[model samples]
Target: MVVLTLAFVSTTLDLTLSDHARKERGWALSWSVVRSWRALTAGTPRPRPSAPDLRTFDGLRVFCMMAVILEHVCWLASLSYVADARYSELTRRDYDAMLMTNSTLVVQIFFLMASFLLAHKILQQRRKNLPLMKTFFETILNRIVRISPSNFVVVWFVATWMERLGDGPLWKPLVGGEAAVCRRKWWTHLIYMNNVIYPDDKCLIQTWYLAADMQLYVVALLATLLLRGRRAAVPLLAGLFIFVTGINFTLACLWRLVPTFVLHRPESVLVAYGGEPSFNVLYQSPLGNASASLAGLLLAHLHHALGDAGVRIADHKVFRAVSVLCAPAALGWAALSPRLLGGGVPHPMAAAALAALERPVFVLLVTVALLGAINGVKSWWRTWLSHFGSVAPRLSFGALLLHLSLNKALLATRLQPIQLDRPHVFFQWFGVGVLSYSAAIPLALLVEFPTQRLYKEVTELINKYKQPTQDIKMDT
Candidate 1:
């Protein structure tokens, strides 16, 4: 009788345990499905990977962010400061300052940042033997979802409400026209093809950077796949550099396009692209802007290699010398750039040389300097700036999306012109930057931050399930 009772109790426990296991699995699956649906419909899975921070790079970002705001301040001030004067007519100092402001080069820094971060993460994943195709798909999706929501906020507001906000001389051309263009071509901005779809000032004029970034991101995925395990990284990089630079050079010469940023174009370059100064299709396209990103890819490889080898190139005199020289080189090129292009189209060879060398040159120089910082050499000011920069991981993208809208609103509402060349101009720019940043914070916290968090959570849940599959050896 006792033995019989023992057997029955054992059987009961077994059934209960089995039942519990089944229920657990079902619950997990259901939860995963719900998360997936929510992520797909209402949010996206955010990814937060554990990676070392390159602080100087962070500092560089801070500097660049402010530089962009300052550039626009001067630009807008030039337009509004002299209420009755044409912007085309400029004083000697204004002209010289305009020619020398290389602030727009900071845009290239954005592409470099994106490329470096993504490439670094991709190579790290590859080391864990993650499926390349799956990773490639996820990376692209992640990028799109990450950038889209915040982008849509700005795009939607511009199209629907900005024109109604205010009116000035700059109002109709800048606001009303932009609203019309965006309302009509919002899809292009949604997909990051605004630069290609609508060439002129319709929609967010500054979003060409975003468009170029997304397009180049796709290209990077393909490149990452091709260079898996670093097998083809070198040759692939070489070919990409040669091809992208060669093509840009060929086209610049063909179109007689100048190499300066839109804000500081040489007169001849202006006529070449029909007076729309800035990176139009010929310069702003993914094809033209890709060399900077490719250089970033190469830098990523070098960064990984240095980590594995545990060596600091900055310790070597020759390498240190090269890194030190980068600053002066960049400054020198920027100052002389206006002279290089002259008033009209430069000599064909000169134009070709500037176009071919411009991107890769700065990228290489910047990488070298960045490499030094990564290896633990940093100035005190750099350290401080980096600390400040690290505090706002989401700020840059937020500012990029928000600043233009803010600028449009401010420029449109002004009853009088902004004073462009006054001694207090620097303070005015500082104020504008503060306002831009302040506006960006809410967007970052509410829209950008939440979306990123949702993405990370869903991704983690999905990966948790994927682990078991990953652990099982597949038949290759």
Candidate 2:
């Protein structure tokens, strides 16, 4: 409930500011304010050459990361005092309600949006003599370097702590045993393939999404390469989406037939595939995520095509109104659909309706919102949202890594007992959330920033060496 409330508030603020900015100021001034508000809020000047528009995507990325963090924190807190069975039925009911409401599908919207924006930038850069392979390889390498170091640090901490605290053999089916597991399959994590085999047993529980994202990245890069020309891009992307969706649908059917074959067992089938164990086929399969990634690719292509026309569709009042309406409508359907039908008996029509209201519809709504945001939604609320969006990339990825890890640490510590029934629980959670953010700020400054810089430096050094050798060969 806290998480939802916060999300609602933040979103409302964003919209309100956007509308105000649009009404009060011209597009140029509104855009300027939106882009530069972070600097103003931070008490600094907007830097020269301006921050990259990719930064806007990063802002959204940070928001998603924060949402995931909150969801996990809420889950951890609910299960914290599970050993105490003395709680009332109402307490248990509340706990279940909180858990249900903490779902992270909302985060997936930002993920898809980021994919779209990033793919757009990648395609744009490709036109300027950039080798597609080099870009693709570099992207993979950067993700590895950026994500793995902190991840491994957390894994090491968790493994050591759990072993000491449990004081017994730690179950490690994937790695054969506790001691040998880290050494053997750690490389799998480094390469982001851990989800294929070790879906249930993760090093850092959230890293599954990292692996999924990496897989999506590879597929997107390939698609971008195959459909580089203007005329071929849309048709190719549409074909790819259909192909991937068909594969996902087929896998979903298979998983329904043989339930255990899916990764993460039954739950994976439902969440990933869409409910029945048969859905597991589609659920565990990376193709669905790849389809969303492709959707993002298409969005990028659309942006470029529209950009060439020098017209901003987002600026149109009708488009903005439609995009704004989609989000609430999707949410309303999601909230009421289950209850209206009564629980249990799952008909095909009901299942299909639920699936329609899930991630894909949410993704479309998010895409519309983003388009409106970018195309000149002038308002103070938008200015504020755009500001947070600007700061998002700088701290978001690191925050995502640290916040959940901190929550785990807190759980492991077994802090002072607090009554969840009390209103103060919200304040306590907020304090913890703030502390997590505070810790993440420095980690972002020290670890994430330095690591990214080092990766860039290494790439530059390699390129320098390769360039001279290439020049020498050409002279000969």
Candidate 3:
């Protein structure tokens, strides 16, 4: 409450301050907290540079985040002593259940976009003859700066104060239990290794994605650096895809792991998948999840390569047709994912094949779709996604961090078991989405944006101080 109050006060002050006053004061760390709200509340779109317009990604990410939120709502509903105890089991037998089950694929889009943008940025830097080592360090620094402060604050809040919000029969075990584990194991999250070290004992289990992503980021950067030239890049990326595919296939077969988290799981394990070996071995492993990131890197390399050669994909009818066809194919694949794996019990070969191909195939199709959209594939769907999906992405990361907790809090406060139906689950999702995004606004304004602004200010000051030394050296 105190933190939220401070954020409100700072945002209010930021709104009242004039432009001149802001320019004079914005550099101060304290004032950056206030000035951050200007961007948050701004009506204008941020200007784009010569780089590819990724506003489309903003929409993609926001949509994925909402889908994940809806999944969590359904998950929590399944966990509850629901009025309709059989709903989870029966729902899985339907076609629409595939939508919820395969929605986990949306997470890969984030992984894909991360590597794609990283490759794109590095390619641009290479054109300007930037130092690879310097760019590498800067990338690490910027990622940490962007992600850590808000993450730390959220972790601390969950650990210390979340249980204080409310209490019920399940509050202690569901809410307080998590907080207690966080009190002891929070360092794993801060270091971004909890996914590897104790895959099950998590402060916020959903955050395993962060650990996987950070680990993959380092691996991708290192690979990009070592295999710097175009000659080495092709074999390196292709070999990486084959290598990761083999690992996923081998692990799935050896461990008999489920291909995806939502598939082949009993109704009892719906909520957290707490004791599921598949969750530990396949779901959280960086290597297991590398296909999407690899797909992103591959697409990015091609994008830059095409741009350098003055080739527009849209100009080629064949390429455009293939790209346009990917959208429906991807949708159909997702919708029938359960059937693809043989929903109840699959043959060993089929399960292994699904593990090997699931992410790569889906990611490839989605990457193609993304390529089309970016390269001027016009459609009403793309138009809607671009416009409506842009702004919410600003809050998407914060919402991701907080949504599960909000869902848990809501359920923890419930005195009666929820009626597990589509309508009720939708209502839960709606309420949780509002609460999560509402909480995220203050979180972003307070911690995330201010930290970014302060980091930029500090870097600028250091750069200014170094300029004279560089000039003097040049003169000498």
Per-residue lDDT over 1-476 for candidate 1, one digit per residue giving the tens place of the 0 to 100 score: 43234335433443455666634443223223222233333421222322344665666676778777776665555444455344334442244464335566667777887887788778776767777778788788888778898899889888898788787777886578668878999998877898877565456767888899999988877786667576557567868778888887777767665555433533422222334523573456788779878877877777776666677565687776666667556655555555665664357667656755676676666766666655554445435656653444446667767676677667767777655554545776677777777777656544565566557656776888998887785633
RMSD of 1: 11.0
RMSD over all Cα atoms, model 3: 2.7
For model 3, the stretches where C-alpha displacement exceeds 4 angstroms are: 1-25, 29-34, 42-51, 227-232, 261-264, 267-271
For model 1 the local lDDT of residue 156 reads 88
Whole-model lDDT per candidate: 0.65, 0.53, 0.77
| Candidate 3 local lDDT, 80-185, one digit each (tens) | 6688667666777577776776777788889999998888777766647667789789999999998999899989999999989899878987899889988989
The TM-score, computed over Cα atoms with residue i paired to residue i, of candidate 2 is 0.71
Candidate 1 ranges with C-alpha deviation above 4 Å = 1-53, 78-100, 261-278, 342-349, 379-385, 422-424, 460-476
Better model by lDDT: candidate 1 vs candidate 2: 1
- Find the 10 residues in a row with the least total lDDT in model 3: 42-51
lDDT at 229, model 1: 76
Q: What is the Cα-based lDDT of residue 201 in candidate 2?
A: 42
Candidate 3: clashing pairs of residues: none
